[model samples]
Target: MAAFARRKEQRLSRPDPSRKRALDARAAELVRLLNARERFCTASSCDGRVIVTDTDGTGIQKKNCTWLLVTHDPCVKDDVMTALEKATGDVVFKFEPFVLHVLCRELQDAQLLAVRSTHCLEVPLSHKGTLMVSEEYIEFLVHVANQKMEENIRRIDRFHKGLELALEAAVPADTLFPKGPEKSHSVYMHRRKRRTAQEQADPSRELEPQDDAESSLALFAEIML
Candidate 1:
């Protein structure tokens, strides 16, 4: 556990490999800012992108989904359309939830940091995320979305600052680990669809190409202590 914390600290002091592969200029900046914080270390992030797949192509076109324009940076409609020009078939602009995962010192620290970020610091985190706690480490998955890509990066920067400031201050007494909002009843009531025989036979055909987005978890809310 101590070693992990030390690693996070070291990461904060150095350049991140993620920055070099950032989808855009803005995403690289967010990666730099969030990883630079003392309270956390980023795991992954993505600036949503437009994908062009040529249906005529064969066998899981590895390079088929050409990134017309990928960026963690802010986006404008004109720029998006321009990138689409290169696309051949099944043009899909997937604005996935801007996601960021980070490791924290402890569960209590994650709770305290979350509360402050929501109420005091005002990070525009998605109304959903995961706070995975363990004796060795604590992880936070921040998910948010916006039509304009830049806004999400700005929010991430604010979230990082919020976590840093919260760590410096004393923990609040009222809600040490504030509860998240209850899940909608409808979510539980809904039944999953069964795959057809063809899908079962060729499961790989049904599988969508993996994107950078993380899998969804139980929804969460901005906590206030």
Candidate 2:
């Protein structure tokens, strides 16, 4: 328990290492809220983005690609056109939805958040350059991507609210820290059994008031995607 607390503190204290070198504005509030809670801390997050990349035919590999343009908010055609002008190889346009990784204080805390997980969408607009699609088609693709961005924002909002409710109902951190190995094992088993019962009772049940925010920190970390 002490180790977990120490790790969380260290991670939260470290400077951001992402390309932007800071929390995305759209997800910053949610990330801050999670870190403020005793039971959870955000490891990493993206608030969703529209990107145009120049790749060496190996697809979306970061090391093999150059990011021509990236925007956290909806992008305009002029911006995309300007980016495409710099592409020397195969170009791809993409819309990646919001993603967040969180660390939980306990197994039960992970499971509780896991139950609220939602599906994420990644939309690819172009496989090659402007050769395969018309100007009108590109405009249409941008419209669709923008729509997806809107939905992504809605999911983030839902997730924020659902987490607020969950944190309020969560057991206090002091109570969760065990005094000994035996007590820790007992608590783990009890939580496991209760989680099993809950799942059996209603397999499809999700966080109340909204069902769109469906992704778990545990699952995201395990997948490492």
Best by TM-score: 2
Candidate 2 residue 145 C-alpha distance from true site, Å: 0.8
Residues 1-225, candidate 1: write the lDDT tens digits.
Answer: 578778887765665565344334444655665456554566666544323122223334455444455544434445544544454544333444345556765454354434222211112111112212221221111112233334544555555455444333333222343444422121211211222343567777643322101111111223111
Write down the worst ten-residue block by lDDT for model 2: 210-219
Candidate 2 lDDT over residue span 89-189, tens digit each: 67777888888888987776676656333434343434545345666777877888889888888877766776665554444434676555544443434
Worst 10-residue lDDT window, candidate 1? 211-220
TM-score of each: 0.41, 0.73
Which regions of candidate 1 are displaced past 4 Å? 6-19, 22-39, 46-64, 72-78, 96-98, 113-147, 150-161, 170-225
Candidate 1 Cα RMSD after full superposition onto the native fold (Å)? 20.8
Model 1 C-alpha lDDT versus the unseen true structure: 0.40
Q: Residue-pair clashes per candidate, as listed?
A: 2, 4
Error of 2 at 216 (Å): 13
